[model samples]
Target chain A: MKLEGKRLIWQEYQKEIADDHYFYARSCIRQTFFPGAEAVFVKIMKDELGKDIHDEQHHTSCTGIGYHADVVPFDTTMTVIARQFALMTEAGYENYAASCVTSFGLYTEVLETWHHFPEKEAQVREFLYKATGREFNKPKNLAHASDIVYKFRHQIAAKAKYKLIDKNTGEPLKVVEHIGCHYSKMFPHKGIGGAEYPYVLSGMIEAWGGEVIDYPERRHCCGFGFRQYIVQANRGFSLSCSKKKFDSMEPYQPDMIITNCPGCPMFLDRWQYALSEMEGKTYGKNNNGIPVFTYEEVAGMIMGYDPWKIGLQLHQVSAEPLLDKIGIPYDPLSKFKGKNGEDLGIPETPNYLKFYAD
Target chain B: MQKHIVVIGAGPAGLESSANLSNLGFRVTLVEKEEVTGGHLNKWHALFPSLASGKHTIEAIVKGLNPGIKIQTATKVTGIEAVNDYFTVSGHNGWQEKADAVVLTTGFQLFDSHRKEEYGYGIYENVITSADLEKQFASGKEFVNRQGKKPERVGFVHCVGSRDEKVNNLHCSKVCCITAVKQAIEVKQMIPEADVFCFYMDLRMFGRHYEELYKQAQEKYNIQFIRGRLSESTEDKDGNIIVKVEDTLLGKPLRIKVGLLVLMAGMEFPPATKALTNMLGLKNVSDGFIQPLDEVLHSNLTEIPGVFIAGTCSGPKSVSDTMADARSAALAVAEYLK
Candidate 1:
C-alpha cells in the first residue's frame, strides 16, 4: 500500500474545527458505556487547554438512537435537535461540539435538511417554541469532539507524559483507528478525512506517536447499527459485524484499537469477550483480547491522567498489557476505586479473555 | 494547387482518415503527440473478439498510409486557427501547417482509477486498471501478483468511472463492458486453473461478435459473470485484494478474496480535446464529448465549417466504429473540398 496516496486523500478530508469556545453536547451512549470519556474530554478542554466549553445540564438527548431505530418521528427528532440549539444559543456559544458521532451525524442531517428546505426550519422553529417556549439560532460551527481533539493533538502530544510507543521495543505501537460510520458515511465532507478514509481518530493516533493500521475491514461498521442492535434477534448480526472486523484485523496483530464513535469502542471492546465466549477465538496475542479505547481516554492516558481516574478499568478487556508495553506505571489495586476513594467492588471475569478485578 | 489537410492525433482514427484522404490525392499531414503514431493502440496487447495482436493491427494501419502523406511524430497541436478560406494549425514543437480543412481524432483517455478510492487502485498493490493489465500482458512476463506468485483468483470490476454519479460521470463508457469480458478471458487463458470473476452492472454486448465472446467466456473459459457492482476492495495481509460486492441476482452480499483485482476503467474526453473545443468554441453534449452537427446525419462535422471530429473524441467508440467514423469524416472532408 502506498502511504503517499493515502496521505493525499487524508489531506483532502480536513474539516474546519473551531479553536475555542464550544457548546459541548454529550453522548448518551458514551456517558453510559464509557462514562469517563466525556468527562476527560471536558477536563482536557477546560483544565488542560484552558478553553471555554459549556456543558449544559439542561440539554437532552438528540433522540438519534430512537430516530435511527424508527421509533421516534422525524419531526420530533428535529424539534429535540432544535431544543439543543436553543440551549447552545442560550449559553451564548456558536460552536457546537458533540461528544457522540450519532448526535454529530443527526445535527449534520438536520442542518442540511434546513439548508435545503427552509420551510422545515421554520416549522421546527414553531414546534420548539410551542413545545418548550424557546428560541434558537443555528450554531455557526458544528464539530465532533474528536475533531477538536484532532485539532489539539499536537498540543496534547507536546504535553504528553508518554507516547503511544512501546518503551521496550522503541517502536511506534500498531494502532487501528475505527471511525464511526455516521461520522462521515452520511456526509463525507463533514468528517475530517471524508467517508472512505476518515482521519479523525487516525490523526490523533499519528500525532500521539503510533502507526495506524489500514486493515481490510477498517471501513466496516462496528456492528452497532442502531436498529440492528436494538432488536433482540438481530443482535447476532451485530456481533457478526464486529467479529468480521476482529477476524480481519487479527492478522495485523495490532497492539490496541482506538475509536471516536461511542458505540464502536464499546462494541469493539465488549464483543471481543463475547466472541471469545461463543467461538473460543481471541484476536489479541497470547490469549489476550485486543484492548479497545475511546480517543478521549487514549489522549487522557498519554497526557498522564490516572488510568483508574479516567475509567480505563471499566473496560471488559484489560489495559494493563498495553500500559506495561508503554511503561506507564499504574496501581492495579485502585482499578475499582470510586471518586471519594471508596471501592465500587469488582465485576466477574471472563474465562478466555484477561480481566483485572481486585 | 492541391488542397492540404491537417489530421490531429495519430491514433486509429487519425491514421485511417489520413490514409483515406491521402488515397483521394489530398496533401495530408498527420500530427502525433507521442513519439510513435498509434495512441492507446500501441499500449494494447490484443484486440477484443479475435484477440489479434495490437502491434500487427497498428502495422497494418501504418502500412496503408501513403509515403506522400507527411507523418510528424512528437508534434502536439497547441492551437488551430481558421483563416479566411483555409486553416493554420501550429504545434508545440514549432511545426505549423496551413490546410484547407482540419480533422480532430484526438481519441479518449482512460479514466484514472485512483479517483475511485473505495476500489483501492493506487493504494493496493494488487488492484490495477484494465489499461495496466494490458501493459502487463504486453510485457510478455508471466501473469503474477506483485509478490510474483501466480494469482489463484482474478476479479474484473466493470463500469468503474462510468454510469456512476459519485464520480460525476453518468454516460456509459461504451467499450469497458466488452473490455472486461475480453480481459477476463485473457486472464483465464493465462491461468487455466485460476478462478476469474466479472462483476458488472449490465453486460452490454452491443457489438457484433461481442456477445459470442461473452458466451464463450461463460461456456468455454468458465468465467463467472456476477451481476453486481463492486462496493469496495481492501488488501489482505498477503497483498491480495478482498472485494465486497452484492450479487444482485441472488440478493446477497459476497466477500471474495482475489490475488489480483482488475478495475475496467472507462473512457473520458482527454483535456486536450476539451481545450480544443474551448479554443474553437465548439458545442459539447451533456456528457462532455464534442457535439456533432447532428448525431445521425452529420456526426463527422462539427458546427465549425472547416473543423471535423472523429473517433472517441466525439464519443466512446470501438476500434471498428472509430475506423468507420474516420472514413466517414474523410468523405465529408473530401466532399467539402470538392
Candidate 2:
C-alpha cells in the first residue's frame, strides 16, 4: 500500500477475495467461549448463502495460543500447521480461511518463512509426511473469514431483514471496528488491508449501512498479548491496553463494536464487565454496556438469525440494548430464562443490561 | 554562453546550490513549486538545543542567493530528459527549460502519520503529526483542542511511520527524535500548566547537543521521557488523547491521557522525486530515496553525467546537512560544466 502522506483513497486499496470452496480453521478460544459464532458462520454459508464451507472434525486447533503463550516450541507449532494443511488437502479445498486473527497471522508468517527459507519448509513437510503420510499443497489464497464476509458485505446487506441503523432516529448505528493486531501488523501484505490503515472491518460496517467510528485508538491491539493475559501478574498490562481504547472511544458514544479476531471481541466484552466491577463506572448510556460482536456473529445478526443461536447471550456485556436499537424483536423472558423450562423469573441474577427488571 | 543549470525544488539545498553555482559563473534557474522557498525550515518555529528561529535561518540563506540567478515560482518540473549533454525539463503550463546540468534538491516529505492509524491523527482532532504542531508554533497561535480550549497535557510520540516494517518503512527518519525533543520543550514553554511526555522506542539523539536537549527536556523543562513506542492513542470524553505504551524500561504498560497528542512523523522520499527519477532515468536505493553514483565518496553524483542529487531528496537530512550537500553539489556541477 503506497500512502502519500497518510491519505487512503477509498477506491485505491484492492484485496483478493475468493468466491467459494473455503476450508475453515476455527480458534480454540472461540470454540471454548463463543462456539456458536463458527456454527452460525457455517450455517450462513450452507443454508443462507449456499457456499461450500468445511467445519471438519479432523481439523484441530492451530496451537497458536500455546505457541504464543510460550509453552510450545516453534518447530512443534510449524508441524501442527503442516498437519492442518494436510487435512485441507484431503478436504480438497484450495482456499484457506482462518476464523482467528492469530491463526491467520501465523499462517501468513509461516508461509512467508517458507517462501524465504526452503529448508524450514522441507523440514515441516518431512515431519508431516513421516508422522501421517499426509501430503499437502499450499492453498491458492489465504484469508481471514472476516475478509471474505467483507468482500460479500453488499450481498449480505441485500439479504438482510434490517440495516444496522437506529430505526427511530433514522441514523446509522454508530459502530466501532476493532482490527486485531496480528491480523495485519505481522504480515500487512497478506491481509485484506495493509497494516497501517486496515479497512477490512470498516468496509463491512460501511457496506451494512453502519457508521464506522474512526476513534483515536481504532487500530490498537485488543490487549491479547498472549502471555500478558496468561501470566497472572502481567494481566494489568493486558487490561490497561483495553482501557486505553475504551477511554479514547467512550466520547464517540459507540453503540456497538465489531471485531475480526476471536480473542478481541471476548476481551473487549469481558473487560467492560470487569471495568464496571473494578471501578464502578460504566461507559454506555443508562449503564447499559456497549455490545461487542465478532464479525461472524454480526453477519448472523444482520441476516436476522436468532440471538440465542448466535451465542450473543454468552457475552459478559449485554447485546440486548443493541438488539432493541436495531428494532430486532425477541421475547424478553427467553433472554434470562431457558426454553420450555420454568419461568424462573429474573429473581436470581441481576440482568446486567436490565433487559429484565430487578 | 555560460553553462546553464536547473535546480529543482526551493528548499535550503535547492537555494544553496543555485546561489553557489551562480557565484561560480553559471546562469542558474531555480524552480520552486511553491510561491515561497524554505521547504520544511519555514514550517519549524525553532531548531533544537539552541532554539534558533527557523524563519531567520531560511532568510539568511535566501539573502545569499546571487542576483544573476533566475527564480521561477509556482512552477513544477514534470519531467527531465537527457538530449546529448543538455537535459530538457518540462512541466505544467507548457513550461519547458533546457539545462546543461540539473541538480535535484527535491527534498523529502514528512512520513504520513495516518499510516500509523493507531495513533489516530486524522481521525481525532486532538491528535496531530509533528508537522502540524510545528505549524501551530510557527504561527504563534494559542494551542487549543477541538473545542478551542487550552490543553492540560500534551504528548509527543516519536517514530510514527519510521522504524516500522508494517508500513514497509524500516529506515529511521533520522531527525524526528531531536525534533520531538525540541517540540516538547516548546510546548512546555508556551503552556507551562500542561504536562509533556515523549514516547519513543529509542532516543536517537545522535547529533551534537541533541542529547543535551534530551537531558534539558527532562531536567530543565520537566518534560517526561518514557522509553517505549506508543501502542495506540484514543480520545476521551473531552477530546483528550489517551495513549497506551509498554514502558519497556519499567517492564509494564502505562496508560496516560493528554489534552493533545503530537506524532513525531518521520521522513520519506518525496513523490516529486519519484516523477523526477522516472523522467531523468534515475534509480533510488532500496529505502526509496534517490541513489547516488556511490554512497561514500561520490554522494553528489548521479548515474547520468551532469545530473546531481541533493538534500533529503537523496535521504533524511538536517537543514545544515542539506545546505552542505547542496554546496558540494554546486562544486560537483561546476567541475562537470568545466
Candidate 3:
C-alpha cells in the first residue's frame, strides 16, 4: 500500500553489475526447456545492444540441480563451479553472468564460502588444477543475466518497438514477477532488490510500461524445489505450492507472470495446465490460464522480435492472449514451425485451459 | 557544597533517579531530549500486570520529583567531560551542568520492524508494530484496520527482533512478552467479540505477576496462544494480513487471516546511548548494551568511577525494573560520592 516505503527498501538492496565483457554461463534447465530464451538473450546482447557476451561451449553445468537434489556432493559442486570460473579466466572475462537463477545462487554461495574460508578456496583450486590443469582468477563481478537486463532496462525501453501497455485499453499490463527463492533467499545482498521484494524483474516491467502487481503470494517459491519435483510422490507438494501462488494471485487478475528463474517460468506456466487438467480450475479470464514468460522472452517480444523466434509458442499457457493485448504481430501458421520452417506439429488441446491452436 | 548529579534522559529511570538523588540532599538535574518527558511511556496506553494508565503512572513519578530538582526538556547531551573529580555535561541546546556523578538513564529504543522484511511490516497495510498499536490505544480512537473497519481478528507476533540470530541480536528483550500479553488483553477489552491470537516461540513470563497475567489472558480473555515463530505475512486484497506460522503444539503449518497483525518489536541500545558510552570510554557488552562492573553485585556501577548506568541502557527491562534500577543507581552514586 505504501509504495514510498517499499521503494526505500528497494533502494537499500541495489547491487553493482558490470557494464560489459561478461562470461556467460548457460543453464541446463533453461537451455533444455526454453532454448529460444537464451538465444534471444544472446541476440539482444550482441546485435541490439552490442555488448560483449562470451558463451563458451566448453563450460559445463554448475550441477545446481543435482546438488540441490542431494545426489552430488558439495565438494564436487564446488569444483564444478571452479571449472566454470577457470573457463571464464581462459576467455579473459572478469564479469561472470549466469543464465540461471540457481547457478547464480550457487555461484554466490560458493564465492561467499570461499571468501569466508580461504582454505576451501585453496582446496577447490587444487581440485580444478589437478583435474583440468587450469588456473582461475575469481570474477570481478557476479550478476544474473536478468540483473544485466535490469541495469539497462531504460535503454531497452528507449529502443523498444512496442511497450507492455495494452494497445486497445492503453492501460499498462499487470505483470506478476515471481523471483526464485535461491536468487536471494540465502544471501539477500547478492540480488537486485533483496530477497523479500526483488526489483530485478519488476524494474524491467516498470521500464517496459507494465504495472507490477504486488499479490499476496508475490514472494512465494515457484515450487520447483529440485528434490520435491525430482521424486515422484513429492511432486504433489511442488504442484500444490504453485497452486497456492495461483490461488493467491487469482484476485489480482494479472496480465501475465514474468520470471528470471529457469524453473519458475516453466513451473508457473506448466502447472497452470496441470492444475486445470487436475481440478478443472482456471485462474485467468475466459477459462484461459495465466501466461508465464522468462524475462528474456518478454524483452525480446517488446524489442519487436517474432513471437515464434522468441519461443512464446512453447509455453503451456498460450501467450497469444498477452501478444494480442500488447498488439505484437505473429503469424498463426508459424506457431508450430521449426527453425528451418518445417512443420513441428501442433500439440493436443486441453479441455478447460485455452490453447491458441484450439 | 551539595554535589550536583546529572541524570541523562527524563524517562521513568531518570525521573526516579533524580527524585531519589534530590531526596538524599543532592542537587539533581534531569535532561530529556524530547520536548515532553516519559519517553516511550508517553506513547503507551497502560502498563502490564495491573493495566494501570501510563499517563497516570508518569504523573505520579513526575510528582515525586522535588521542585529543587532542575528539569531540562529538549536538552540533548552532546558531550560529557571528566575534569579532575567533577564532570561537565554539555547539551546540544548550549546548556551546561557541573556534576559530581552522572546517571545514564538513556533507555533502549524499539527495534526497527522493517528489518524483518518477510513479515511485510512496511509493505503491507495491515501489518503494524506493537508500538504503533500502543499509540492507537493511547489515542482513544476506535481500533480499525487500514480499511477503517473494526478488525475481526487481531494477531500479535512475539520477539520480532530479539533472540533472532539473523538480525545479529541474540539477547532477549525481556519486556516484549509481557507487553504483548498486556496489549492482547487490551485489544480484547476494546473489541470483546474480536478473536485475538498470540504467536510466540516461547512465552517468557519470568517476572512476578507476569505469569499470572499470561494465564489470565488465556483463562479469562480466551486469547489463543500458538507456540510458533511467524515465518512470513502477506496482505490480502481486502487489507487483511495472511500470516503463515507453524503451530508447534500441533506440529503443523497454520495460516490465519487477521484483520490486523501486530509485531512485538524488541528493545536494543539506542545509538545516542552507544555514542555517549563510547565517548566516555565506558565498556559495552557484546550485545552493545552498556557494561556494568558486575551484573550480579555492582550492576549500577560502571568501570568509569563517575559514570553510572541505570534502566534499559544496560539491558532490556520492564518499566518496574527500570525504576528499581534507577533507585539502585542513585544509591550507588550516593555511596560513590561518600
Candidate 4:
C-alpha cells in the first residue's frame, strides 16, 4: 500500500525480463520528426536492459493517427493491427510496444475488440491469415517506452551511479512532469493507471530522488491539434498550451520538466521558444524555461547511461545550463559530437544531474 | 486590497482568465451574454482527440475559482474606458465598475453558415452546422434526417465561413479541420452503419493524436476524405442532399448524395469586441481580434497596461489551445497585479 520506498510497477517488469526482444511499432512522426526517441529506446533496451528489440522494416506503421483523423477507415485500422501482429509473430517475436500513445491505443483497442466480438475477430483474422499466411495474436501488452521506464524505475535509480547536485541551491530538484494526451486522455482507462495520475513518468522522476510538482493545468492537452499550427498557423494555441503548464509550475519554480510523449515535447519546447519571441519577456527570465525530456532519456540520465545514446542532444531547447546547474560535469563543446567529431552545441550535463547525488 | 479586474465573456477563455486571476488574489468580475458559462464547450459532448467530457472541463475551470470572482450570466459589457492607469467598465442595469487592470477575454461567435448560400445550410432540411450537431447531441437527440430515418450517409463540409477570400475571411479557422475529424468519428460511433465523408482542402492532423484520430476514423471507422470544398448542395426527390465539389486531389468534379450535411463553421469576434475596444481604447487586429501588444511577446498582454486577452478573442483557436492561452493570460494578470 505504501509507495514511498517501493519500486513503481514498470520497474519490476524490466528486472524480471532479461531479453528485450520487443517488436517496436513505428510512428509516422518518428519516421519524420523525432527518430531519436526510438533510438534511445533501442539503445537502452539493448545495452543497459540487455534486450534485443526487433527493428524489422517490414512492419508498417500502426496507421492509427490517420484513422483518428477520420482519413482512414476502421477496416484499415484492423488490417494495420493484423498486419503488424503477423509481422511480429512471423519474425518469432511476441512482446510488442510503440513509442506513440495513439498506436498503442489502436493496437490494444482492435485486439480487445477482436477478442470480444468473435465474428469481427474471425473476419479480420481470416483476412490477415489469407493475406500473410501467418497467425497473428496480439502481444500480451502494447506499451510506450515511458511505461517501461516507469516499470523498471527502481533498477534505473539503483544503476544510476552518478547524481546531479545543484550549484545554486546546493539541493536536489523539484520537477514537473507533463504527459501527452495520447498516454492518458485519449483513452483514460486503457493505460496502467488512471489518466489523472498516470504514475508512469512521474514515478520515474520521483524514483530518481526528485520532487514532482503538481501544477494547475497539469491534465490539459498540449494543443498540437495535429496541423492546426500549420494549416491555420495559430501560434497562439500552441504557445498558450505551453504557457498553461509553465504558469502552473512557475510558483513551484521547477528546475526542469519531463514529458512522456513526443508531441508534448515538441509543443512544450517549441512553444516556450515561441512564447519568448512573442512576449519579449522570457519565462523565468529566459532561464525559467523548463528543460523537457522523454521518460527513456530521464531514465538514461538517472542510470548514468550514455548521453549520446539517450539522444539528449537532439532536443530543440538546449539542456546545457540545467546540466551545469545540476553539477553534472558535461563537456559542453566536447560532448554531442557529430559523425566527424563536431559538437552540436548540446549541453553535457542533464538538468537534473545535480539534484540527485550518487 | 482587492483590485477589480473585469472580464467580458463567460466562455472558456473568459471564465478561465477570471478564475485564475481570482485565485491570484484579485477581485474579478466575469460578464457573459449567455445565461450559462463554458462558451462553446457547453454545447458539445466531448472535445477532440482526448474526447474529454466538455462538462468536466468547464466544471474543473469553475472549481478553481474563489468567491472573489463574480460570474454574471446574461450580462453584457456595454462600454469600457481607460483613464490613465485605471479602466472603467459599464454594462446593463447601471452595472459599472473600476479596475486597476482589465482583461478582454471576450470569446468568439460561430460564423453564420447560412451566409454561404451555395451550401444550402438554412434552405436545406438536411444541412446543418457543427454547432447545430453539437446542440442536438447535447439535447440527447439522435442524428436523424427530415424523414426521421437513421441517415445512412453523412457528408461534412469544412471551412464554411472561414478561409474564403470571397467572404474576406483569409484567416483559417484553426479548429475546423480537427472538429470535422472529431465529429466524423463521433458520427461513426453513434451510427456504425453510417458512411461519413469529409470534404476538406487538406486533412490537418497537426496535433498529437490528431493524426492518430484522423487515422482511427479512417482505419477504424472507414470514413472517406475528399480534398475539396463543396460547391453547392441540392435536394433530390427523396430529400437527400446532393453535394457538388471539385475533388482537389483527384482534379475532377464529383457529385455525392448524402442524407445529412454538416458544415464546419469558423470563428468571429463577437459584436461586443468593437464596443469594448472603442470604449477601453484597446487595440485590435484589423479582423477585430484583440491585438496583443506584441505578436511574438506579450501575446496575452494588451497595450493599455493592465488589459489582457486570451482564447479566440485574440484569434481563432481550438478548445485545448484556448485553455492554455487562458492560463498564460492568467499568469500575465498575476504578475502585473503582484
DockQ of 4: 0.01
DockQ of each: 0.74, 0.25, 0.77, 0.01
Best by TM-score: 3
As for candidate 2, its clashing pairs are: A248-B235
Please write out the lDDT profile of model 3 over residues B1-338, one tens digit for every residue: 89999999999999999999999999999999999999888888888888888899999999898999999999999999999999999999899999999999999899999999889888888899999998898889988888999999999999999999989899999889999999999999989999999999899999999999999999999999999998889888888898999999999999899999999999988876777898899987889899999999999999999899899999999999999999999999999998
The 10 consecutive residues of candidate 4 chain A with the worst lDDT sum are A349-358
Q: Candidate 3 regions off by >4 Å?
A: none
- The digit string of per-residue lDDT tens for model 1 on B251-276 reads 99999999999999998888767877
Top DockQ: which candidate number? 3
Model 3 alpha-carbon miss at residue B116, Å: 1.1
Lowest lDDT 10-residue stretch of candidate 1 chain B: B270-279
Q: TM-score ranking from best to worst?
A: 3, 1, 2, 4
The docking quality of candidate 1, as DockQ, is 0.74
Clashing pairs in model 1? A13-A192
The candidate with the higher DockQ, 1 or 3, is 3
Tens-digit per-residue lDDT, A1-358, candidate 3: 7787789889999999999999998888787788789998899899888999998889888999999888989899999999999999999999999999999999999999999999999999999899989999999999999999999999989999999999999999999998987888899999988988888998999999999998777777798888778898999999999999999999898999999998999899899999999999999999988899999999999999999988888899998988989999999988899969999998998888998873
lDDT of 3 at B139: 86
lDDT of 2 by residue, B219-290 (tens): 999998889988777665567787888888889988898888888888999775697798767898778999
lDDT of 4 by residue, A1-358 (tens): 1233123332322322223567776666753444456776677777777767887787776776677767888877797788888888888887887778777767767876877897988888888778777778767656776676666677767777544346577676777787766765555555554354556776677678777665445665675755545446675666676686676567667777777765777777667666665664344434446677766666666666556545565665566666667655554454457667865553343332221111
For each candidate, the alpha-carbon lDDT, in order, equals 0.92, 0.83, 0.92, 0.73
lDDT of 1 at B41: 94
